[model samples]
Target chain A: MDLTDRPDLAYDVFAKACPSRGTLEHVTGRWGALTLGALAEGSLRFNELRRRVEGVSEKMLSQTLHALERDGLVHREAQPTNPPRVDYELTPLGHEVAGRLLTLIHFLEGRMDEVLGARERYDTARGGR
Target chain B: MDLTDRPDLAYDVFAKACPSRGTLEHVTGRWGALTLGALAEGSLRFNELRRRVEGVSEKMLSQTLHALERDGLVHREAQPTNPPRVDYELTPLGHEVAGRLLTLIHFLEGRMDEVLGARERYDTARGGR
Candidate 1:
C-alpha cells in the first residue's frame, strides 16, 4: 500500500512506544546497517556476509539477519544442498531503505577528515578526553 | 571541501577500525537519531530538546549532544544569560546528515504497517516469539 493512500497511519518515531522506533533501531543498528549495506551489492552467503561486515560475531550477524528478515527488509534463501546453502539479499523495500542509508553512510565517509578535525579540536579544548 | 576533491579519503564503514563506524553509530544510535531529528527543525535549549525527543533521559541526551558536537555534526551554544541558556542546533554538516537520516526514518515510518505485518507472520510461523 502506498503511503499517500493512508495518511491516517502516521507512525511517529519520536513516541517512545511506537513500533517504528523498534524497526528503526533494527534498520540503523550497528550490525543491521552493515548487513543491509553488504546485501545491497548483491546476494551473499551467510559466511560471506559475516566476512564483509567485519567484527560482527556469528551470533550478532544471525540476530541482525533475523530482525531484518522479520521487518521485511531482507530475504533469506536456504537451499537444500549438501550442507545446506543459506544466502541473504535485500528485498525491493530493502533496496530503497539501504539506498537511503548508504547516502548517509557515504556522506559521513566522505567527510571523515572534518570529523577527525572536530574531534581533535574538541579533545584539545577539553584537555583530552 | 567537496568529496570529489578528496578521493584518497575513502573511509569504509565496513572495516572494523574505521573511525567512520564510530561516527555512524553516534548518528544512528537509539537516542542520537531522535536528537538529530528534533534539532533539524531548529535550534533548541537542552530542556526543550529533552522534551521534544521524548523518552530520552537528561544524561543520555547530554551524552548524545557531546558526541554529535565533537563530530562537528552539532553546535552547542551556551548563552550568557541570567541562568545561562544552552542551545543545541545542527551544524551545516549535521544538517546534511540529518536530512539524509530523516529520509530513511520517514521511509521506515511510512512502511511500518508492512513491517508490523511481516512481524506477525514471522511470529506465527515460529509459533509466536
Candidate 2:
C-alpha cells in the first residue's frame, strides 16, 4: 500500500509483513543512523556526508542517502555550479526521525560506563576477559 | 584495552577500531532491535521471543540474544524445574537503551504514510508501481 501518501496509517514493526519494518532497517542501519545524526546539525554534500559519517565508503554513503531520500526523511538538491553542487538536508520528517535516533545514540554514548561494567562482569563471570 | 572496566573510556562510533560501533551494530541489527523492543515490556521465553519477534529463526534469535547478553543488555535466567525453563529479561541498562530504540521505532511506525508517499512518488517517478 502507498503508505507515504497516507500519513495517518499505523504500521507495526513486530508484524512480518509491515512495510515500516523495511523503513526501520533503512533508517537505523549502520551508516543510516550516522548519516541522519551527521545531518541533524545541517546539510552536507556527498563528499561532506562521507567525511562527517567517518569510515563510510562512498558506495554505502550514496546508498544510505538514496534510501533516506526514498523514505522522505531527507531532501536532495542539485545546483548548477562548476562542479554541480549537490547538498542533502533533512525534511521535516527527517529532522524528527534524526532527533529520535540522536537521542538514542546520545543515551548509548553516555551510558558507556554501565555498558562497560556489564560487559566486564559478563566476561569475568564466564572466564577472565 | 578493557573498555568494559573503564566506562569512562571514550569509544568513537566513527572510529573504525571503537567497540561501541560494534555494540551499536549488535543493539540495532534487524533482529536485535525487535528483540530489545520485545523485552522492554516484560520478560519472555525462547519460544515467546521467537513469536514476538515475528520471523526470526531459532538460530538468529539465539545469536541476537547472545550478542545482546555479551553487550550486557540482556539477562538469561535458568530455572531448575521438571523442564529446564529459561527466560530473558532486559538489564537496567538494557531497559534504558530499549526505551530509546522504542521511541525511534514508534516514530517510524507512525510515519508510515510519509514513507509510503516517498516510495510511491519514488516508484512513480521511475514508472508506475
Which candidate comes out best when scored by lDDT?
1
Candidate 1 C-alpha lDDT tens digits along A12-127: 89988889999999999989899999999999999999999999999999999999999989999999898899989999999999999998999999889899999999999999
Candidate 2 lDDT over B67-99, as tens digits, reads 899888999999998689999999988999999
lDDT of 2 at B87: 94
TM-score of chain A of 2: 0.90
lDDT over C-alpha atoms for residue B103 of model 1: 93
Local accuracy by lDDT, each model: 0.93, 0.88
Q: What TM-score does candidate 2 reach?
A: 0.90
> Best by TM-score, which number?
1
True contacts kept of each: 0.91, 0.70
Q: Pick the candidate with the highest DockQ.
A: 1
Ten residues in sequence with the least summed lDDT for candidate 1 chain A? A1-10
lDDT of 1 at A23: 93
Give the CA lDDT, 0 to 100, for residue B49 in model 2. 93
